[model samples]
Target chain A: MNETATQTVVRLDRVGKTYGSGESAVHAVEDVSLELEPGKFFILMGPSGSGKTTLLMLMGCLLRPTSGVVYLFDRKVSGLGEAELPRVRRDNVGFIFQGFNLFPALTALENVEATLNLKGLRGEAARAKARDLLGHIGLAKRLHHLPEDLSGGEKQRVAVARALAGNPPIILADEPTGQLDSKTGRLIVEVLKDLAHNEGRLIFMVSHDTRILGLADRIFTIDDGHLKD
Target chain B: MVSIARKNLFHDKVRLAVALAGITFAVVLITVQVGVYLAFLANASVLIDHTEADIWITAHGLENFDFGRAFSEKKLYEVEEVPGVLWAEKYFLAFGYWKTPTGSQETVQMIGFDPETLVGAPWDIVRGNPQDVKYFNSIFYDEAETNRLGDVPIGGETEINNHRVRVVGITRGAKSFIQSPYIFTSFKNALNLSYVSKGNTVYILVKVAPGASVEAVKQRLKETVKDVDVYTSREFSKKTRDYWMINTGTGVALLSIALMGVVIGTVIVANTIYTSTTEHLKEYGTLKAVGASNWHLYKIILEQAVINSVLGFGLGMFVSYWVIQVMKRGNLQVLLPWPILAGVYVTTLLMCLGSSLLSIYKVTKIDPALVFKS
Candidate 1:
């Protein structure tokens, strides 16, 4: 993906994120800079404790950088207040977690509709949209099933549908296939790859799964808070 | 948003039941305690509440009707001479002992009034008639006191203060809080049984003329009758109730128990809400990651608290209604007025909302970044 031709959805400029202070202070991410453009599957690959999740969080605008600037679609969000950060994330960014963090009490369709509700969509319109998103993720028959009733792969698919409910320009996923079997993990990666290529959405994911590396357009490795291309 | 809140609350039926139980227990405890206290106050002034007199003249420094000395009967003559005083009668009240058939003695409050005018007489006679007291040694006994008074049948004789008295009538719903059975008789017979000398009375019952002001009549009697206290019926009733409730520590004790019920309810509700919030902390983090604001989270929790409060309060009131009915059957007056019920409902709602504060604080502080970790 050429940066000059395509639009840049996420950019991190020499960002540093530190946790705690004094003797116990830990630098989670240091001097990490990157730009992600639309229509590409970008992967942040690292071992455990390599700060991949922290970098993803930083790029997702869920965490503030201790140094340098972070921008989402040319808007600097690293310095935004608590109230403003959520608006930027909700309007432009969608997230998927490794645990498939669906509300156990809500059904799959209701879980997807929750995101639409957060976006101020309501009534039958939101329900129809949620149904379509679940159907697109191959979970049309499982829409009314709860997280506890669905298999792990089905739960991850519901999470995918929920993340896509808002139709944001960028999707940030952290080890979304970590809890699935190899066959299911590959299928999940295929769906995400198709979303980036066909839907023209920027996709950023962090994982240690080498088996899925062939599917990424670009890969960046992080170790001990340092990034390497 | 409300659907999510409803689902979360109904998901765990056992937890929901436990939470409702705690709230119901609190409501019943507080309501019953307050009900009993109100009933006690009502009973303390039962006579003053039911009497037909407009004014009462008692000896000076009389705190209540129970413990007061008899004043000279001549005060009634002076009170009758006051303007607006239509008529007046000497009434007698004194504590005396009655010997039961089993050789056990029971305390009795001997009330004496004019048999001709029937002023200050028992109005709830279940058997016989008020005029029957005109016979010598004739008296009326409360039906509720049949057990303590040895089931004295109508037209039966009993020994009161070593003076033989015949029970010619039975009264209903006239039980006193002091646990002393009331014996109604003629003024002469009461004086004889109480061992009081002739020409003295404990209270002077006065009636005001039609369209006349009771307060004005009370003032006139106070001025004309020297060294005696004059009070309108309402004023005396309040004074009597206050004397027993506030000065005697009964009000404070019952009120403290009721307040304790509120405190216990609040704590139980708060603990339950906090636990539920903690259990769902991860889901909240996911919601934040999916773009839910702090306000959205707050609305969900507030809805949960409100739903619990309404349902639990309804159940509590139902239980309290049954408890009050049981008490009534036992001849214990439990007054559950509409105002008290409304006040308790509002307080219970507030208590449920107050309990959600801790949970709201915890939820609002959940880090959305945690969703990236797992």
Candidate 2:
């Protein structure tokens, strides 16, 4: 376990994020330092305006930190240009948003296939991979359903399948259960935990629900843009 | 993968219908306007094109074939004696009033030619033979003029310039540019009906000998026949068409309307595509976040535009063909040559592609971060 901890998949060295400049500047995240390893589910708990989502975005490579450095897989990413960030995110991270973010026009199967296409998997290979992923998430029966036709829990399951498409090493979920009932929320969290514990992938989730605290292997509490040990 | 471009365009059926309708309207407007303009030019030079003469000798300062001035008949003999002139004949043309049997009068173009040679004679004769015009005071009237000429029968009698004449033959498709019906007669009878004297003629039609060059013969005729313009048939036809195309504002008006259609179609496409892009902006951001490049996004928008253009152009051509058929019944000529059809297709494509730029610009400005917030 000590050897595994030394191999950090994601590291933030004294990272900070500030919006705007001069008098109207807002310090969203201040001097936060952390290291995350594979095969563990880590959760960040905070209230609104606490910068929990901003910190998750920085880890997912969706947002660049205004100050300090962000390292992913031991590669420096905070210094990379905007044009190079998307490739890093595509190869390393998968995002599950609160809204489920499935294309409204495409079916569940098509949504997952689209992501696989981005990963350069197309034709029969992409189709087979998408089907296998959806089936793994227990959505084989609803493969043809559109987002509008699916229930809230089912939509989240499809989103989970999309996030698991390329089998990325890192999974970033921003309030994945914010819009779900307690039972459905637990079901989604259990599936995410399985991917971390059984598949040895990194699961980094941001949420304010204390109910999920028992399922997390590690938890960090943020208040007023600062993290507490 | 999936054809996201096709899916996005087809998802909103209502918007697609509106865009197609706008493009179809522009195509119809442009086709009809330009078609009529081309038809008018064709009609202006119809007689000159149909004549078998290789060279036309008209009075100097001739504006067009329809407005020929009477030159001396002696130029016919001089033209015949030219080095390359195989034969020369008198052809008379002048405007006259035709008093119907019911005493109603309508203006008509009186054309005179030799019946034996058959040069400058009315073709597609439906009622009587060309030799029938050789009879005393015999003439021919076009069947297309039935509306204005009151459907005169084969032996029908009418008065031209107050002189009584019989309609010995009925010709078809000898339409005039100014909508005046053509009345055909022999040179002897035309001299008695019109104001021109027997020794004067409107034009001298000359044929170039097979072994002689028309240009050299034309030059010789130019020197031999003074105070006259000698032109080949093609040159005369072009000159006549250009006279009407430039002097009359009809050409400019038609072209302006056609250009207006292009502009209106572009605006319609731009507005509709822009609105569609704005509505689906969130989906675009999601695609951006999921590893789609800017080029991929542009392909989606531009592909939608090209599909709209092709579908609309096909439907518009169908409607234009139907309208042209309907106009033919009323003798309103509208021609869609192959070149014009191909030109319209390209124009439609360009209009739609150009209009799609507005939507592409909007998509380029979208920030992928908005997807997480919304």
- The interface root mean square deviation of candidate 1 comes to 1.7
Note the B-chain TM-score for every model.
Answer: 0.92, 0.93
Candidate 1 runs further than 4 Å off: A1-6, A21-24, B82-86, B97-106, B123-128, B141-159, B162-172, B207-226
Please write out the lDDT profile of model 1 over residues B69-181, one tens digit for every residue.
Answer: 89899887788899999888888899999988887999999989888888888889899888888788899989988778888888889899888889899998677878788
Scored by DockQ, the top model is 1
Which tens-of-lDDT digit does each residue in B192-267 have in candidate 2?
7898877999999999989999899988988888999999999999999888888877788888998898999999
Residues A1-229, model 2: lDDT tens digits: 2234447999998989998999999999999999899989998998999988788877877778888899987899999886887688777788888888877778899889988888789999998999999999999999998889999899999989988878788888888998899999999999999989988889999887899899999999888779875
Q: Which residue pairs in candidate 1 collide?
A: none
Worst lDDT window (10 residues) for model 1 chain B?
Answer: B365-374
DockQ of each: 0.57, 0.47
Candidate 2 DockQ category? Answer: acceptable
RMSD of 1: 3.2
